[model samples]
Target: MKRLILGIFSIICMVTANSVQAQDKGPEFSKLDVSPMDLAIYRNDKDQPVVRVIYSRPQKRDREVFGKLVPYGKVWRTGANEATEITFYQDMKIADETVKAGTYTLYTIPEEKEWTVILNKKTNTWGAYEYSEKEDIVRIKVPVRKAPNNIEALSMAFEKANNGADLLIGWDDRYVKVPFKTAK
Candidate 1:
């Protein structure tokens, strides 16, 4: 009985020591991203959200955004870090183009006076480096409107409209509005 007790105690001590050593090898947290991921949800009511956008917010940091860093006529991920993704809970008419209920990667082409907002069937992509026009579901042009004030970071929000809402994307000193209507 004495030997058995000693053996059990030894096993327990070994396990405890091993556990402590294993914990010492615990996870090393990665550094936070400079452009953090963000979300924008459009809800008509408390429980009924029609649209949700997941993207990253890139700061201007006193740099020129459009026609320079972003460049004209080139596809953009619509944000920083991972490509922007938009989800439609129901069928939606975006910029007068109909899209079925699903998720899509959002891209944009920044121009001098207008921007072409694109919705691609592909998802889980990083930047516009892998953008394919063949995968695009819809591409609509929206005129750039001067920002009411200088914006330091890329921002997106939904505003109530007659039938649905309008998605506003703004950065630096310019902004654009993309219309969204419920398919009726």
Candidate 2:
């Protein structure tokens, strides 16, 4: 009985040690790019655009190619490891409505006609595999556009526009745009 107890305790210690090592590994940041994209949405508030989405993403692996592998219509986690989260410095309007500023998980519903961008209440989750609709904070539909060239890798870019800049998501060389307006 004494030997059996000692063996079980040793196994438990080994298992715990392995789990601690795995947690310390975190996510493989070296294998991924952490490019930051800056976004600005102008509001009539005249306080400079209070709404900004600091976005970033990793390049797609050959097997994880967008559209071809991710497919046209599906729920995308929007980023790697932890869900793609947005930090709102202040409140902003979506389709002329109000959304308080804070960190939020961004999910998307991609379709040929229009793309639905969801601000989910859930944060720090792996891919959309465990996504729950109950965690949605907001859902806004946006238009999709065809790219002139093929983008083999997934990318997020913030480009300046005449009115408000675009937070662009490009993959398989295609792109989508979601416009925001400030509440008067």
Candidate 3:
């Protein structure tokens, strides 16, 4: 009787220890200098709060500028390595409408006429190569503009303002412009 009880106890202890060991042996993360989304809020002249979305990545040259080799009127992953992603901590309006606070995938349609920026429900996709139309959350049409100097690389930035921000996308001597403002 005592021997049986001791055997069961030992088995339980060994199983618990093995489970812990397995968990500890899971994937290890290294120091990765990865780009992340930058979101912020500020006030406008009327003291109204505004929201902003900033997407940044390491700049690379010799790569194909979007809309040319990347093509126009198609979904773009919006980033180099990973599908572009954005997070909004607070409720904000884009293009004079309201959107909830959440994480979203960002896509773009590059065209000679104008560019379309899309906010999608799905998050964390590899690139536009695997983009699915069903995952799109919202689409906003933004205008395209030419840059003064040649960029030769793809980059995006959001400049905070009193009421909103300027969504500036630049690549290879061209640029696209967009503005996001909070709805009342």
Candidate 4:
């Protein structure tokens, strides 16, 4: 009986030790991304954000951006990991076109002179690989302009205007502005 008790105690100790070791291993860090995630929010006077954009910022990394990494006339996910998402809390006119209050996936087609910005109904998508034109809610063509300086990471900024705002998207010495007006 003493030997059996000792054997049981030994097994318990071994199991406890193994469990402690496993606990000390911590969380696994498997996935790593060079480009990090970012967000752009435009708030109203009430401190409520009317527009929010969630996306990943990809660095230039000494590579060509527009015509190479993001080819011209091809649909781009507009970000790194997942499809860029834009949430509008209120109905607004984007580029003189009406956009209802909802969440939509923002895709882009970069060209040398102009860029076609698309708001698609499909929200949960990995990349532009699964993008469908039939699901698009709005498609606006905005002219691209030369940036004053190089923008290493992709960025979007909202500039407040009179009863409206301008959404500026810039990267790699180029930028495009999409003007929007809140629906009355």
Q: Whose lDDT is greatest here?
A: 1
Badly placed stretches (over 4 Å) of model 2 are 1-67, 160-164
**Regions of model 3 farther than 4 Å from truth:** 1-64
Q: How many steric clashes does model 2 contain?
A: 1
lDDT digits (tens) for residues 47-122 of candidate 4 = 9889989999999989999999989999999988899999999998876678999999999999999999999999
Of 2 and 4, the candidate ahead on lDDT is 4
Model 1 lowest lDDT segment of ten: 38-47
Off by over 4 Å in 4: 1-23, 30-32
**lDDT tens string, model 2, 53-102?**
54445555455565656566888866554567665556656665566777
Put the candidates in lDDT order, highest first: 1, 4, 3, 2
TM-score of 4: 0.85
The TM-score-based order of candidates, best leading, equals 4, 1, 3, 2
RMSD, one per candidate, in order: 6.0, 10.1, 9.2, 4.6
TM-scores of the candidates are: 0.84, 0.64, 0.65, 0.85
* Per-residue lDDT of model 3, residues 122-183, tens digit only: 77677777777787767788777878987754677666743556667777767876676554
lDDT of 4 at 176: 92
Q: Flag clash pairs in model 4.
A: none
